[model samples]
Target: MNKLSIIIIFIVCLILFIVLSLSYTKLGTFDTVISSYIQHFRTRPGIYFFQCMTYVGSIRMYVPVICILSIYCAVRKKLLNICFLVFNLWGSRYLNQVLKLWYQRPRPDIHTLTTATGYSFPSGHAMNAAAFLGFIAYLIITEHQLRLWQKTILLVFTTLMILSISISRVYLGVHYPTDIIAGSAAGIAWLLLCILFHQRFIQ
Candidate 1:
């Protein structure tokens, strides 16, 4: 990794550490308010859209779909992006599960709108969305042959997908706002780590 990228990664890791520490200490008043607002949105029709989209974003089940597409792209274009796709798909899934287990925070049962199992300190949907979409964004942006407009469109769509998936978890009442925040932070950290590794060892 370049000096600048290393610095960025350090900063991200520092911020993530601080955030996770504070989140575990106690829920601040603002945190409570934001969580309430997120739960309020859960009742709206928009949530259904986000929920379905988030479900689709789940990498555990979606990777096979992506693998199929990746195979098609590889065969048609003679591209060798399959290794990168597989690495990202597997790496993100393992990291998400590890973080979830490490946190071990219980899901919100106060208003229990959905029947989700497992801990909830970090929203799995948010993490999966960010990692999956962020990796795609990185690939599109880094592929020198791709047109600028195409890269820009891919970046925007990927960002929207990440945001929508995050909102879905909060709206579904399965995760707190802080959970999504942590998940997004962790996901970005994972993405940066992957990029750094690739640049240093693979690129």
Candidate 2:
């Protein structure tokens, strides 16, 4: 996408975040309904599945992947790519923390399938999944010269990864549905801004 298009999307996502934040009380009903519905279908296999997906979204997975990618960039002498990658991931993580502290929203009172401790307005896992994986998808699309079939496969896989990670938080009962939505909006906004800056300036 062009810079202007990215900027517009960034703004739209920002507005979406703001709207969700302001309407959180009303959203709470929807959140509860969805959470309950998801929990209603919860199975032992589903729990195990989401547990793995949640771990994939965690820093445990992100840090190593980022380190490896950074090293790859270094070996290839792609300083700009290295900088953009680190800045995008680290910056998004830091922003997620700041937003969590700022919102200070409580985690769901439902029976949590996994242990989690934090203010949970915007799910950290959701933010990380959307920002990091979403950026990886963007990088693959923009950087690689893949065939149409390959690109389609990559896009589908990347999207599933992002959505699975985000939904896992809700499934685990540690985050509300609105939290996932808000985190996704914020993450996408930040990702777009990073891409726009990297493309327009350093790149």
Candidate 3:
């Protein structure tokens, strides 16, 4: 949220995105290694868990959750937060779409636990979950004067949700590992921008 922290996030996200893009485009050895590693560990339980997580992460499922949170925020007169949440959710999805079209990466031709129809360089579920849950974590840390353990627990849960969704995409073979990495990087970058914009203009 601070300038230095924002700069670090930007730098790291950029590096991750660019590296993943190049590797995915070239089908490089590193991409192969990571994707193979992820696919090798797939199990029935893991697939079911990830399928559930992806459903939760999907716009179809998560939009209602967002709506409920927005309503709560509106009742509290936190208009800025409500706006930020909607903007982050929709805006990041749009951004992810743009990136997907630009890359036009095809879905992997491996066994998939669920049906998916879209370009797969960046998993939309991963991006959306990271952006929305990352926003929730950010709000918690900034607005609540909670104890250290409380903040830590919340942040860890948020991180786990993000990772679980991303890993699920890989396990289901709908996305390459690089795709999730890129999605996560793009999501964090967008979320950071939204956070900075809200902090600068709204509060």
Name the top TM-score candidate. Answer: 2
- Pitting candidate 1 against candidate 2, the one with the higher TM-score is 2
lDDT of 1 by residue, 10-31 (tens): 5786598457746664875655
Model 1, residue 201: distance off in Å is 4.5
Can you give the lDDT of residue 190 in candidate 2? 84
Per-residue CA lDDT of model 3 for 165-202, tens digit only, reads 88888788788777888899988888888888878876
Q: Rank the candidates by TM-score, best first.
A: 2, 3, 1
Worst 10 residues of 2 by lDDT: 194-203
Q: Over the stretch 1-203, how does candidate 2's per-residue lDDT look in tens digits?
A: 78778888988999999998888878767998899998887999999999999999998999899899888878878778878888888898899999999889999876798999879988888887888888888877776688899988988998899899999998989999999999999989888887887777754
| RMSD of every prediction | 2.8, 1.2, 1.5
Cα lDDT of all candidates, in order?
0.72, 0.87, 0.84
Give the TM-scores of the predictions, in the order they appear.
0.83, 0.96, 0.93
Assess candidate 3 and give its lDDT: 0.84
